[model samples]
Target: MFNRRNFCQASVLACGAFAVASSHLANAAAVMAKVGQPLTEVAHLDWLCNAVGLTSTGRLFVGLPRWPGFENTPSIAEVLPNGTLKPFPGGDWNEWEPGKPNAKALVKINTIHIFDDDTLWAIDQGEDAGPHGINPGQKILQFDTRNGKLLRSITLAPAVLPAGANLNDLRLDSGHAYLTDSGLGAIIVVNLATGVSVRRLADHPSTKMSPERRPIGEEGRPLQMPDGSDHQVHSDPIEISPDGKWLYYQPLSGPLWRVPTEALRDTQMSEKALGDTVEFVYDTGPLTGTAIDSAGNLYLAEYDRPRITVLSPDGSLRVVAEDPKLWNPDAMIISNTRELYIPVPQSARMAANRGPGGVDGLVRPFKIYKLQLPALYGNRETVPALVGKPLA
Candidate 1:
């Protein structure tokens, strides 16, 4: 149910144990109340648990990659608050380019983001991967949820294609967007109004920390690859400043990196000049997913030791809440009321397909823990942003 391009993204994130950078909170803490039912039912998908995005009305969208030797399977699916599950009609997580609107392209959508109107923007991630694991190259498409119709596809022009680039995660500031190229290592910019895109930080060290040099594992050990070796780290999840100043990002497998959004959009400046503008934000060991709350607190899916941790606004940090139950938490969304909705995307089966040392999927069962935060679960009665969306 998960597809592997034989592309090793180093496959790990908030899937295993929990690591805390602060000793103020108890080391072995529990935040999960474990009271809710499976948030929704996914069909023909053992990979639904990977990447997740939710709309204002509580409509949940998910992405799936080809798992095992399979190439064509349902890749994208949606679930209602009431537990109804269905494919996104035209969303597909498999092929490089999304299936055309008229067919069953509904299965290949990946890397999803929901806008203010809850309009769904899904990244095709190039249904197929070329050299360096780059998919349909890098493209973004906007679809109308009111009818699952293919609205528009945002393709980066040849001027923006810098070597092997795959559009990774992104965040919006005003009407502009900042994105990461996990494949060849680059930070990208897109003007929402002009549809103009630019590729920057083509090889910035901060954006491409060779996985070899990152900190060792919790026990001071190293991450093991299928060959019993450690792969170099790369780029991933990013967030744009609400004020539109700084853009925050990190490797799906490295500490966080931040760069000036304006510096990237500047066509006049050379990449060398832009690289000089990058700043090191968090030294998070590794994460499967990253999210920044309206409060400016950053959430990371700690991969090595699975748990969702937060970087407070003041820079102080702590393990928000972690449990094996949290699983391989990938892309996540925070509701208007501060309740965190995590989409635990399964990655084990994905790893195994690459070779060994990775496990398989049992559809990566999940349970959404609705709780108040000090990073942990408290019985708070705030109206969750997604509460309006019917889960029934």
Candidate 2:
């Protein structure tokens, strides 16, 4: 019963719809292809590095952990504009021998952070050549980036640092510094002015690796310890909210957590009361390093995948960048200009992962990659109020 004109009109409408659909599909493919295209290599080093930090002025610093194979290398280095690694604060600070005094040298530097005030803070895990343990060498060092001068060195007391305590990362407020003990599952709160420290939420379920959340390596398999058991890392990643009111932290195998800064600063708060204050924030999968933007967004280094995911303030998560070369992106930092510096140390390829080739499986010239953040995060001018202020 259809007329020729009506049939022709219907065909025209169908063709128009088809064209629109095709355009949308093509646009989507372009976006997917661009996801990781912005990732650029910032530096490449022969030694393994686990952490990176950026100052407000755009200077970059990296931490070289004294791992089994990298014992003779410098513990900390500044990446020059020419892409050369120079021992930072130079001289004896980078020299640590087996029999020498550990107090004067950098031993097993785990993480480094550069504050807006242009001060660099480095955490020494204190394990010289033995299993993870507490020693007189466990310390947090503050250096003036302008002159490469040592400002303050705070040694963690054995009373606060237990036998298996592996001080992993640090975040600072105006008056205090917070650290994570990965090996023993605790938060060590240090008074910045007095150097006094107290262990908080010790063995708390929130700090401990979840019994169900087994860590997975970049190879898409559960990471195992040398004993053939599931590899476990307790509290490892930690960050302070831009406003300095909340602290976000979690185990390497995570469900992200947060607690109020006021509660953490309270020395008299009972362990049970402090534990009660910890709030479950998000169910972040296995991640290594975390950085917070002025927008209160958390940028996470996905430990099991080759991507960086940002967790918004409202609890939504999205992958901001992805690349095949982002192997085990450890600790990351967001610069004032809204660029993220990611260090891919390939910890999964290390000897502990039990790969087919042991340490030989590691790729040489460990890379530190960077990505310009999306415009949605905004730059320093947009978030000027918190740009150079004390995080807390």
- The TM-scores, one per candidate, come to 0.75, 0.85
* lDDT digits (tens) for residues 1-392 of candidate 2: 10112111111011111211122123223322234326888999988989887776667888999876789979999989998888988888899877778787898899998876767889987754234555558888888777778878887777788777778899887778899988879998998777788988885787899768878765556666556677678999998887788888899888788877888889988877877777777766788888888888788887776767777766556667766777679888877767888999888777766433344468989999888887777442122221245332
RMSD per candidate (Å) reads 8.7, 11.1
Q: Candidate 1: where are CA atoms >4 Å away?
A: 1-45, 67-72, 91-108, 132-134, 214-233, 349-363, 366-370, 374-392
Give a tens-digit lDDT track for model 1, residues 318-388: 56655555655678667655566676654533453233465444353444443345433222112222213
The most accurate candidate by lDDT is 2
- Cα shift from native, residue 103, model 2 (Å): 0.4
lDDT, candidate 1, at 155: 74
Error (Å) of candidate 1 at residue 294 is 1.8
